[model samples]
Target: MSAAPSLPVRALAALGRPVIAAARATLELWGVLIGTLAGIIRSYGKGGRRPRGAVVAQMYAIGNRSLVFVAVTLGFIGMVMMYQACLQFSRAIGDLSQVGLQFLRLVVSDFGPTLTAMMLATRVGAGIAAEIGSMKVTEQLDALRMSGVLPIDYLLVPRFLASIVMTVALTILGAAIMYGAGGLTAWLSFGVNPRTFFDPAMVQPRHLALGLVKAVTYGAAIPIVSGFCGLRARGSSEGVGWATTAAVVGSSFAVIALDFALSVGALWLFGGDL
Candidate 1:
């Protein structure tokens, strides 16, 4: 009979554990959000050390290491789009001569940049979150603060700058490869000449503009998502794993969501062909 009272106590404890956990998660998320914002502000305000060298180092790490991954992924993306489009177009329309045009219209305006961005997000966003989260867990962030170094200026700003640059550059490369490489394959497969593939009149300035926009949006998304997750990391190896997964998933969703918004805006502002 006494066990009945003990059961209720245990039940309450179990329920209370979950509620406390939920509160803690909410607090952690908010803390990270706030901390990231503060970091951004601090990055902008940093002026010491006669212009810090840390930004350069960070740029090298974030931008340079990421370039090869972006390029290789985008190259394969180009091949896939070309191969798929060729298959579909040949079956339906027999307009193989228009392959370059088709590639430009679809890949340049949308898929190439978006896919490339998502790939970069997967590679870089998770990495950043894990690296930073691990750093935070190990107290490296605190060590930086103790040394009187503004961590954001030294850490986050470089990542922000590098990611934006990398995204834009990689997107441009991806679009080119998709259009150029895809066009070449189309030409070779269907007996079309090189002139059809290289003609400048086939490309649209508006689509190019849209590609750049996608790249910039993607660039902005990766670091912010990564930084957010990194800041939010707490407890155990499981927490680091969770943060990495969240960073990748969150950044991917943000990239896709932003791409859609950009596509719509581009289409509306620049016309349907965009």
Candidate 2:
């Protein structure tokens, strides 16, 4: 009886921390969004020089540096998706066409793009938070502000744009690879023609549109979460680490929740067509 009570207490304490942390994170994210928007308006009102160079640099950093990791991760995802899908298809159906359709539905509709975004959020989003948090701790951001540089436009906007580009590109690439791998596996196991794998008709335009919407949504959400978490850091190394973790976790939850919402919205909009 005592053990049970103690376990509940500990669990509640653990749960409470995340709840408070989430609330704080939410406040910080709103602050960053408001501040960034205000800064944008101010820049436009005063005809302030846009930080075009910095934006370009940030785009390159976020999009380019992330490519190798995204490719490798996607490759493995493709391989595994092929193997598992083949096993499942083998159990129920003897037709390779059926397997191909199943693969298309799974990859195009949800798994490929959603999983890719989650992985990117975990990998690059955390890094962005830590980097910003470290810079804040060192007063580098303050120094930039003192020098008349708007950090949001210079740093955050580029990341925001880059995330969308990266998410879309990576997901498409992953889906292609997964389809190819699954096709190959199906050919070997069930003697399906490999060419039957990537029928243009199977490439649903609606799924692609859904993926684009999701990528852009995630792109916007990640930078906001990361930038906010960094801004809220308590100016210490430990704080930086904590902020990084918060950014990843918060952004991940945001991605998943948004995916579900988008799925529902997409269905409502296009379910009749499908």
Candidate 3:
């Protein structure tokens, strides 16, 4: 056997391991995304049929199940946010007038979709990973492959389609709840007029477009990342647990990174108008 490596060499190896792993994971994620897109395209092609009612089932699982959770969370967040904004304005500018307008714009362009996606990343991502990971460890995925089925097409495509639709719908619902709750808090706590606190004048069409784009992108990302993690699961239950944790972390990170990149691109494209 060769001599053991030195401390410096060992440290370098340790550092390089994670870097290599990260690069590999990134490439794998891109593959999963591309495969998912191809699956979607193929499903819509001639003589192609998706699993019966699969998309709707997934929609109910991803969207309907998440409604109350999203609403309550966003409502309280909005209330707290508005209270803080009013307090700051009272202390600094002594003007609560523009707070709602600015808050609405921010929510529409960023907070609404981003926050909703973050919440779903935890709930939906873990579920997807755990389910698929369980199947993976049981060799169910292998069984599917043996049966002449593409796992990405049968498993991921429905979730992908459902997530996109539900994410957008939930984002709209969450944004509305957030804004409405914020306005209520401002009125009750700060004596601000409801009319002034609920103004939508400052929210532009670009803000709407940006929020829609972000919602759709986030929706697409969560399922693909989670499914990829699931497909890679090994061992037994422990592997499923690991995949679940990774899916949550990875999906959340994707949302944040995508948010940053999209926001920067929007800012660049729209300039000061954004």
Against the true structure, candidate 2 has what lDDT? 0.76
Off by over 4 Å in 3: 1-11
Better of 2 and 3 by lDDT: 3
| Clash pairs detected, candidate 3 | none
Whole-model lDDT per candidate: 0.74, 0.76, 0.95
Tens digits of per-residue lDDT for model 1, 162-197: 778777777777667766766666666665576775
Write model 3 residue lDDT over 81-120, tens digit each, in one string. 9999999999999999999999999999999999999999
Deviation in Å, model 2, residue 74 alpha carbon: 1.3
Clashes of 3: 0
In Å, residue 87's CA in model 2 sits off its true spot by 1.3
The TM-score ranking, best first, is: 3, 2, 1
Runs of candidate 1 with Cα error greater than 4 angstroms are 1-52, 148-150
User: Model 3's lDDT to the true fold?
Assistant: 0.95
Clashing residue pair totals per candidate (backbone < 3 A): 0, 0, 0
lDDT of 2 by residue, 120-222 (tens): 7888789889988998899989998999877776667667766777677777776676667767766776677766765656657887778778877877788
Rate residue 161 of model 2 by lDDT. Answer: 61
